[model samples]
Target: MAAEMSLVSVVLFIATGALVFFLLFLFAKRQIMRFALRSARKPHINIGADAPRELREEIQRRLTIVQSVRFEPTLLSEQVLEASKSVPNHYLHRMKALDAFTNAVDCLRSKDTTIGLRGTKQTMQLYLFTLCPSAANSSQAQIIDMFCSSYNHARHHPANFGNAELTNYMELLDKVIRMIKDNKKRRAAALYPAVETEVRLRRDCGKRESAETVRHTGKSNNLRLQARRNQPAASRPEHVEQFNMVDKSSGYSSTDHSSSGRGSVERLISPQHSFKPERDEAV
Candidate 1:
């Protein structure tokens, strides 16, 4: 009996310990979830080094206002209506909102069409893109449908949005912004090598062309000089006058031995017979 009683007590203790441990686990899970939610809800602040201070401040201010605007838990939450009412009808605020929206869209590397879209239209476009990137290639009708549906839902069915819908959208926007910046960096990196290679190729080509030009010019100049050197001196204009004067001075005289003088002049003019061969074999 003592042994049975001890066994029962051990079982009870084990069960009690398990229940306590289960409760602690639940508590820990709850705390972890809460912390995660809080962290997600918190806004991240970053000022662009490239952006002007005023522009950065304006963006921050607008984002702050957007974060402050929270949807209610109920599906019938008039979140937009409430925000509209709470915020004054000041043109400055409207302008700020528009500016912030445009700037953020620009940051995302969006097309001119997307950037041109105003207010809720732009939001819908981005949201649709986030959901289905291929939707960008969809037909005009399909695109129109998506835009109309999003507009209708946001305007008429505020209750359909989750409590953290606005926050989620904001997060998505931030993610897209980062993605665009990363894409630009990657493209720039990829293009740098190509640009450098092209520049190097062009430089090499230019050098080759210049070298070839110089080589061709030198060859042509050398050929011209060789031609000039190979030219007959008698054909030269400078020696023509001297040849004429020699001819006039050495002209045949009837009083002298005309035949002999003519023969001598002919021999002087013709180098082929500079040395005459013996007509008779040693008389």
Candidate 2:
């Protein structure tokens, strides 16, 4: 009986341990799922406020206002009324237009769905129209209008724009702004004649150097050719006449005979012997 009771106790202990493990596993799984859901709902935040110093300086330089009129902050607002005579109306109109556009874009990002969509579409259309206004109908305006319509449709149908879609749109907008700034920089560069002149001078100097190098190379080749022509040819041995003289007296050696031959011939053959016969010459 005691053995049977021990066995039953062992089975109960095992069952309790398994139940505890299963409960812990369930709790862990729930925590993991909650973390995943929270991560999915979180908005992406751009980190780090420090931008490259060069980029900041470039932005400041480009945005520097070019104004002939100076006014104090305290009295500027009131002075503006009096200064209206000097200030161009067109300039004021442009400022007001830019302000309106900025405000419209900000309003489009509001929490109210209907107002946000309507404001966004209207702001987009306004920006397009201002950029390109045509009596016939501007292509830029038409494109913006189409994009606005599509955005409105997408907003109403949430499935049309998931997280990826919104991310892509933001990326595209960033690229467009970057391209616009680049184009503005290029246009500014084009307007500066001093910069262009410096570039031209640098190019001209490079070309001049290349021409001088070519001229020097040609001169060197000509000098080398002239030097080759002025050089002398190899010297050859001098030619000497050979004469065969047989010696009747064996007392003289060949070297002695060779050396004495000229003197002996000169003594034996006189100017008179040339006109006389061989026997007379012998006598």
The candidate scoring highest on lDDT is 1
Q: lDDT tens digits, residues 130-227, model 2?
A: 32223013122223343445445443443434333433333223222222222333333323323211112223644753222211111111232233
Give each model's whole-structure lDDT: 0.40, 0.36
TM-score of each: 0.21, 0.21
Q: How many backbone clashes does candidate 2 have?
A: 0
- Candidate 1's C-alpha runs over 4 A off are 1-83, 86-101, 106-163, 187-193, 196-283
Candidate 1 overall Cα lDDT vs. reference?
A: 0.40
Q: Count the backbone clashes (under 3 Å) in each candidate.
A: 1, 0
Q: Candidate 1, after superposition: displacement of residue 89 in Å?
A: 13
User: Could you tell me which 10 consecutive residues in candidate 2 have the lowest summed lDDT?
Assistant: 274-283
Candidate 1: Cα lDDT at 204: 60
